[model samples]
Target: MITLRDVVLRRGVKVLLDGATLTINPGEKVGLVGRNGAGKSSLFRLLDGTLHEDKGEFQVPAHWRMAQVAQDMPETDQSATRFVVEGDVTLLAAEREVAEAEASDDGERMAHAYMALNDAGAHDANARAQALILGLGFRLDELERPVNSFSGGWRMRLQLARALMCPSELLLLDEPTNHLDLDALVWLEAWLQRYPGTLLVISHDREFLDAVTQVTVHIEHAQLKRYGGNYSRFEDMRAEQMALQQAAFARQQDKIAHLQKFIDRFKAKASKAKQAQSRVKALERMERIAPVLAEADFTFEFAEPANLPNPMLVLQDVDFGYPGEDGAGPATIVRGVNRSVLAGQRIGILGANGQGKSTVVKTIARTLAPLAGTVTEGKGLNIGYFAQQELDVLSPRDNPLEHMIRLVKETTAQGRLSGQPTREQDLRSFLGTFNFTGDQVFQAVGSMSGGEKARLVLCMIVWQRPNLLLLDEPTNHLDLATREALSVALNEFEGTVMLVSHDRSLLRAVCDEFWLVSRGGIAPFDGDLDDYQRYLLDMAKQAREAQREQARAAEPPAPAPVVDRQAEAQRQKQRNEQLRPLKKELAQIEQRMAKLGDERAQLEAQLMQATQDPARLAEAGRRLKAVESELATVEARWLELSEAIEQAGA
Candidate 1:
């Protein structure tokens, strides 16, 4: 267990935790949630022993092994699998012992070392590492690729995989889902559910917290408050508690007023002078109840567009992707895409990683031109595009006010400025609406946190009064409250919205429909996020199977074997016996898969009909999850059995 009693912690002169007390039991999956700068990360630092409390007692089990994702971008030439495998310190230690034992030629030491190595999972280390890598959305071919070869985001994923690979009693994850796609996030949620260890995760994703965490620890007003359940439960309980506190505060205020009235009116009179003094003393000694100030509600709205363009944009036979280097042909990611963005339409874009979701968004945003088709915009169409890389569109050296000033200048010069606020004071006030205020508005964008930068981007977008909004992963850096605000704003906005996000809650809230960008094309997804998740899982499974097939195909053919009829017949018989059980299991798995598939389909249909009945919908969802889990298990076993059978035959 981890315990902190009357802990006083600080960053420089700023007190983060003052007399905060918390106790987290062993094996508890906890969600540490707070505002962006609420010291969640600092608390993690304390747990990992990087920081010491300035006062009072803080204790973690002394012998607990801890694993945390490295914040630094990994720059290594080692293969991804190797890098992740090396994260298992016990395995590394065991391997070192084995090497030393071999060098010493000590029989007993060698025997013990081998046993330790096996216990450390040295034999299946690569397999375990690859499983993590794949679960985190890496392609099979990328498993053996150099770690440094990946982009920054992917390198961060590798870092996460590395941390997960480690054998630890305690795991610390900060924003683990930020770099993950929906599929990878789902996989990670499932993985964490099965983790038999203490998990402390700092995340802004509410659904993720609800799915994985049983306890929520909130940091507010320099105090740590423990809640009994998940984030949603915390919110409900917190709301109720705040309401009660506010009522108590109101009652206290009335009492204070009554006492003050008596003291003021009678203090000058000889008859009540003693009583007035007594009352004054009582008032002074009374502990005042602090008013429950509403949390900094960061809410903003899109300025009503000057013009609403029906069919805001149209993509005709579009091919979305990046241009190749060295004068090569363009690399098309999504081809023959025919899509139209109409006014007031809310479309959520869905796809697995590397499936061109961003490519499509970029093309629509005009950041990338379609390789082989025409993109026609409706008359007077104005676009507000929030890219995944918000920084790319921002001038890091420029502050929020400066960015808005420049935007005003650009729009005015282009004769597009109309009723929008253009004055510096108005722009400053507008930025304040998005929570950028005073000195923060003047702070360099580059020095700001990701959430601040994202707010600046949002502020700029809202300032444009766009008829079409294209948001790609806009909620990646936003907290739950801010995400909720965005969802509300988007819902109320009088324009079309095309969003690409891994946040299912946001997607379900904002998107009226979904478009799937897959297999070099864009099409409407018939089902909801649940179906899409299952699709992603199935796609991952197929990709793995395909990679396995490719590996088998790539292997050189074995040299022709000598024909010894009697010996071959005996060997063949032995192979058949070895394969029989495996084959039977594979057949059973196939049958189970079919049964689960049918049940899933039926459940989905039932869910569609059960929308009006909350209880039925909940039950169907639960059963569907169970079926999917079983199906996944069976499919894995089937794959393993099939591989074994093939190897046995060979």
Candidate 2:
């Protein structure tokens, strides 16, 4: 559906894309993989028409629409729902026009209005909005909360939801999965699997691209290279290609050397002059092919935290709660909970928002004191904590280099290495591993992406090399690729870890056990994410069963010792049945919407490219619009289902 023909893009003297050509057909999902500063975002902008290539052509249908996932938040005071609905301003406008047309009773205009509304999927828009909101981890209550009240992570989700809501034949996503939790990530993966329109996604997540995309496009040295299959598949193919190319270059070098020797030996000999000249000419015409070099291996040298005696921290009968405003009332968030964090135990904490997971982490980190429980620090123990809000902790005015130097000294007062050993050089070398290079090292921390800041914070943590790592949603704003890389790094780290995260996959991959915090209590599970998830399902089922039993017991069989027994029984029965189907329907809609989305994308792309005849094009446009509208409708249904399910289950 889109093609970049011999594209050449340059900024000043640096060429970002040199004679690069790429083709994305309908229903093809392409992953654009590259390191930092390798033109991933620039390429997305080029496609979005925000930037232009110096040479070559970018071709798409005249009316083809495109949407890009925004990384930074736009200034807005609206709620998350409003933010998402506003993303497709065209749809909102079309809805208004369609409404007016229907009111006037103009057949032609009304028909156009229906198509517009259908294209915008006004019917299903709410469903899509709810699904996205939930998928992005927003609660029903939070959906109505003002966007400005949310943190950057939540703001990014709003942007993501907006992009997903828009109807576009082509979607350009850059690090789109950075802010999503496991549930949302899973939903997104499922959505992409069934997406029909062409997609060009830039991500650091290997497994994500592998699961969602069919093609891998690598950009390096200002050139584009295509590989069939997903990320891992591409890696294998690229490796083979590089090996073959290197062999070819080696043979060419040998031939050139031999020819040069012959030319030198026979230059003055009349009998061999013709052959020598021919060899020289051949050599002159030969275009040298430089062999590709593999990137340097990254060393994640963890600095160990200071040694402590017990290697264990325990919270004995902890009573914790959020303080009521002006001490009006006691709003207990957690109460009378006992928890033990042991040495060599990699525990994963899981819970819904506002369940006091962060509060628990804070209590353990000693950042917050328990209301009633005694928090005992293990002897000779030193803890290193990695918080989700890394950006908020740092001074925005200071550059990365300065921030690193300052943080290192502050966090690691007893850092093994004494004195600044070439601060600039050390900073550059350390930053380079995270893909920051040259002038980028000097850029203010404020200007960096969430992923960038996360990377920097992680790097700092590893540099200090703590004995026990306390990571609270460390993967919050990281791309999938980076997350996977982190998994590898954490796996290799020797120290114990205590992580409070919603990323089930990461928890499964890196954690050896689980510490589920709920209702102000910490429950330990000795298993992986699968086991933990099974446990949750079991618990939820138990809760449901308990509610049902209570309802049945509340109903009076006879009339003895009961006032209005029939009415009471009826009310209990009504309550029991209320949430059952809602949960089931929500689950069904979630799965169906993903499937329908893929189908709709396919249909939309076909409609976009099927014809040029005005009548035919117009019809196709209407159909495409309808499909998009239907998609939104599906999303809305899914949302209602989700809310219903939550209510029923509750």
TM-score of each: 0.84, 0.72
| Candidate 1 collision pairs | none
* Residue-level lDDT tens digits of model 2 in 1-650: 67888999986687999989988777789999877677888888787777898999887766877887776776778877878987776788887998899899899899778777787778777767766776666765677788899877788888988988887878888877766654466668877787778888987666678879999899988888888899889989988889999999899889889999999999899999999999989998999988778765444445444563454787788877655678587666878777676777777777655677777777677776677768887775666678767854566778777877886677556544423233668877877877778888788888888777887777766655566788988876675557777788778766678887766667778887776667667677566665655655565446447656875898878755757988988877887688667767777777877877777777667666754567876776677687678779878787667656555556
After superposition, the stretches of candidate 1 with alpha carbons farther than 4 Å from their true spots are: 265-285, 552-650
lDDT of 1 at 501: 92
Question: How much does each candidate deviate from the true structure in C-alpha RMSD?
Answer: 13.7, 11.7
Residues 95-134 of candidate 1: C-alpha lDDT, one tens digit per residue: 9999999999999899789879999998899999999999
lDDT of 2 at 417: 41
TM-score of 2: 0.72
Q: State each model's CA lDDT, in order.
A: 0.92, 0.75
Off by over 4 Å in 2: 71-79, 88-90, 99-120, 265-274, 296-298, 304-310, 319-321, 328-337, 352-356, 399-443, 448-452, 462-465, 475-489, 500-509, 518-520, 525-650
Best by TM-score: 1
What local lDDT score does residue 260 receive in model 2, on the 0 to 100 scale?
A: 97
